[model samples]
Target: MDDKTAELRDIFLDATGGEGTVTERQAERRGSLVDVDDPETVDARLRDLVATMRERYDFATDLETDAYLRLIRGFYGDETDAALADAVGVDAETVAWARLDCHLVRDRDRDDDAPDAIRERAVAADREATRANDRFRDAFVDLLTDADLSGRLTSDSREDGLREATEDIETNVSL
Candidate 1:
């Protein structure tokens, strides 16, 4: 394989949890369909792999994932929900819900209230804020600005970093 093809293949492999090198489990399931000479085929497979990754990780639907990925990649700077949605080709509501699911954004509520009510309130507040200031629009941006976390999520170390972060949060759980 040429350098570029190898690199792209490695990227998709890692993105789909292959860790640069295919695992025995993957071989069992996918059976090594990659063709180094066929870059287009590889690209198609990579796209499919990314779709599967998005579904498995629950990163939001395809539109939301595209938007979130753009935000994380720094393509959109402090954009409001509508702007981001337009940029990503999804609705503002989809972006809003994805932000919450990704844990990289939150609304303006801190009271210790019932979970459902708090969520509803936060969503309503976020939607209104988006419509009003547009600055207050869906994503807060800074929530996932930590370099370590962002680096991990953007690179091959995503699973490990996520695991560590989750463990840290679990340890810090007060109750």
Candidate 2:
């Protein structure tokens, strides 16, 4: 890929926190990819469009949101655009725009032929992160519950306890 393509891909990946692919149906909905001789123009147009879409959809670049998107795509499996949108809590047009973003990222040759394997890896990684977060949250909550700070304690002592508790929990989590 060219420098412009690489940079655009990085931007999309950073914004979405996932390197998803555009399916054939999504490509159809997206109409056509940008066609320009100058990579700079293509990059600028794509960046602006993605920015608008991201803002309009209010897509957060966080693990929880990434997990929800992944789950929606994984479970929907060949479902219609509207169905997927409903499941993911986004409008159908936003769904199309998201696919457009993915298309721009993977359209190195301006063709919608990005491999599904990349998207699969991205989804799996997101799911793994989600699970790890859940485990850490549960462990921390458990520690807080078991501690039961009865009386006022000195700052140093509280800090020490917190450090020790975190170390102990981290040892058990295995993540």
Score each candidate by Cα lDDT.
Answer: 0.50, 0.44
lDDT of 2 by residue, 88-159 (tens): 676654554444333312232233453454454334434543644544224322322222332233556888
lDDT of 1: 0.50
What's model 2's TM-score?
A: 0.21
The TM-scores of all predictions, comma-separated, are 0.30, 0.21
Best by TM-score: 1
Clashes (N, CA, C under 3 Å) per candidate: 0, 0
- In model 1, the number of clashes is 0
